[model samples]
Structures are given as structure tokens and as C-alpha cells.
Target: MTDIARIRLLTTVEHSLDAGQQVVSLANDEDPLTLKDRVGSIERIELHFPHFTDGRAYSQAYLLRRRLDFKGDLRATGDVLIDQLIQMERTGFSSAVLKEGVDPTDAERQFERFPAFYQSDVVNETPVLRRNTPES
Candidate 1:
């Protein structure tokens, strides 16, 4: 995984951010591409996951990263689970606020358990096999 896609695990919703940083929170149904014009001005974007079963936020994150090219922080909020962290990191979330009662330690272990992926991700466009192989 690339450094740009490293996921920061947060146990609580409360965050200490810089005073000047601009944050925009989007509901699960909101389309991230709509904010294409405002991407530069915003410093962070929070995408909501109303429930564990809902996956709209994943699409939003992909659009923001690959489509709109949002370079600032992308955070996952609400109903986040430890099992989703690996996929979340692959999709482009820089941080996630875990749901209540979910152990942060266990969430951290998820990364350790699956250290690498073969498929390409938003941060790492090259597939693992392609990255390792040299042109003949």
C-alpha cells in the first residue's frame, strides 16, 4: 500500500483539527462529483455510512479521489467497522471514526493481518504483479 492511502484509525467522533481547515460533511446519498469546483478550497471531506450494510460512501470516496482528484483528507464517519478498514484504505479513506464499542486495537490488527493486496487501488494504480515485473 502507498503512504498516501494509509488509514488512520480513530476510536471517537471528536477530532481536533486546525482552526483554518475547512471540512464538508456529506450524507451517504450525496454525490462527491458535485463538489468538483470547491475541491481546492476544502481541506477535508467526511463521508457518512449510516449503516454497516450501506456502501454508498465507498463510491463517494472513489469519485472524490479518482474522479474529482480530491487530495485533502477523506474520512469515514458513522457505522464504521474493523472489518471494513482494509477495504476503506484501498478505496481512498485517509481516516475513519469507528462505531461505538469497536476496539481500535482490533481495527489496527486488521491492517497487520492483510498487509498487501494484488489489485490496484486509488493510491497505488499499478497492480502488484505489474509493479514487480520488468519489461521483457
Candidate 2:
């Protein structure tokens, strides 16, 4: 990937998804509903959570995956805390850019805290009860 398209100093949500860029970062308040039709075309989309308490991005992630069927990179950016990584992954975030001060090793461990998920999520599209395989 070219640095021009791959590395961007994103501080806000002003990205206009284009063929040239591999990533598009959005703000917490930006509505994915407005971009539904073209979401599938983008190779990667990053949803920002400006604050740990703001949960709007969670819905945005779900809409992109379950509604728009966005199958590419869904990354989490800004204020990404250790406690939220697993949930972020469950909500369709393929990767994350943790804010300063959060240790990468600790975050990695936290992500593996839940080896099994129950409900149907982006990580496991099939609900445990609906799976054909036997339960653990």
C-alpha cells in the first residue's frame, strides 16, 4: 500500500471515500446511513470513538457489516481503550489504533479474554445456538 493512501493524520471526520485511498476514517457522530450504498466499495473504513463513553460508533460498525455487508477492514480509532477491544472486534472492527498510553501487549491479552462468544456478532456471524457443530 502506498504511504499517501495508507498513512493519514486523521483528527476529524472529513474523509470522502475514493478509489485512491485504502482507508477512510469517520467521526463518532458521522452517520453511516448516509454512506450505505458506497460502503462496500471502500477497502477499509475506520470509525472513531472520540470518547470511551460514546457508543455511537458501535451502531455504525454493525450497520456497515450487517446492513451494508462491508467486508473489508473495519478499524477502530481514537480513544480506543483496552476494555473495548473485544467488543470492538465483536462489533466488526478488524483492527484498532489504541490511543497513547495504552500498552499494546496488555490490549492483545485483553482481546483474547473472551475466547467464545454467545450471540451472533460480526466476528462470528452465526449464533452459537444456530451453529451445526456441537457446543463446547
Candidate 3:
């Protein structure tokens, strides 16, 4: 037998978060512009890709990484596929939650599909030839 000794009260804070430590979820409809003010302190941003065809998440990821300059973890959840893995990494998703039954090994193998890229992207910020070529 157990007796209830004490109960603690749970209170909610009504203040603006200081150096926000919260992981904010931005939906496809929710513009990342709203987070501009608090982007710096955001530890992580989870961009929900409701379906594979919805490519808005790609733009959101790029905006967050390139425009906002967010260096935190950008995770993709929902409808993640092995075929889109490379694009996800290029756009700036540091981690992803792939759909069920998709082999992790296969998804990882997709990254190696292209050994090198000619243009710059979030993954390879510099063009390969430009960096490798010596000054004339």
C-alpha cells in the first residue's frame, strides 16, 4: 500500500523565452519569416514534409540555412524517401526520419550516387573546380 504524501503545483510561464532553448516546429504553411527574430537561439528546427511531392520543405530548409544562417540541426520528418535523401542533404536537413520499410543502408548509399557536383549548394558551398584550380 502507498499513501499520497504531497502534490506539487505546475505553473506556466508568461514571459518571452530567454535565449530560447525550445525546438520549434514550422509547418509548411507557417512561414520561416516569423522566426527571424528568434532564429539565433533556436537549437533545432523540424520541418514537416507532409508528403513526398510537397517540395515546399526544400525551400524552407534552404531559407533557414542560407538566409537565416541557422547552423542548428534541421530534421525532416514524414514522407521521407531514399530517393530524396541527397536533395534533403543538399537543401540542409542534417537528419531525417525516413518512412517505414525504407532501408537505412539504401538511403545512405544514395548520397554516394554523385561523387562530385559542379555547382555550389548548401552541402558543398564552393564549386569544386574553383576551389581546386590555382590562381593564374
Best model number under TM-score = 1
**Candidates 2 and 3: which is better by lDDT?**
3
Better of 1 and 2 by TM-score: 1
lDDT of 3 by residue, 15-80 (tens): 122223668889988888788999889887878889899989899998988888887777777787
**Candidate 1 at 55: error in angstroms?**
0.4
Worst 10 residues of 3 by lDDT: 1-10
Give all TM-scores, in the order shown: 0.90, 0.76, 0.80
What lDDT score belongs to each candidate, Candidate 1 first?
A: 0.85, 0.71, 0.72
- 1 or 3: which has the higher TM-score? 1
RMSD of 3: 13.8
lDDT for position 60 in model 3: 94
Off by over 4 Å in 1: 1-5, 16-20
Report lDDT (Cα) of residue 74, candidate 1. Answer: 91
Q: How far is candidate 2 from the true structure (C-alpha RMSD, Å)?
A: 7.1
Listing every candidate in turn, what is its Cα RMSD in Å to the true structure after a full C-alpha superposition? Answer: 2.0, 7.1, 13.8
After the best TM-score superposition of candidate 2, give how far the Cα of residue 29 lies from its true spot, in angstroms.
1.7
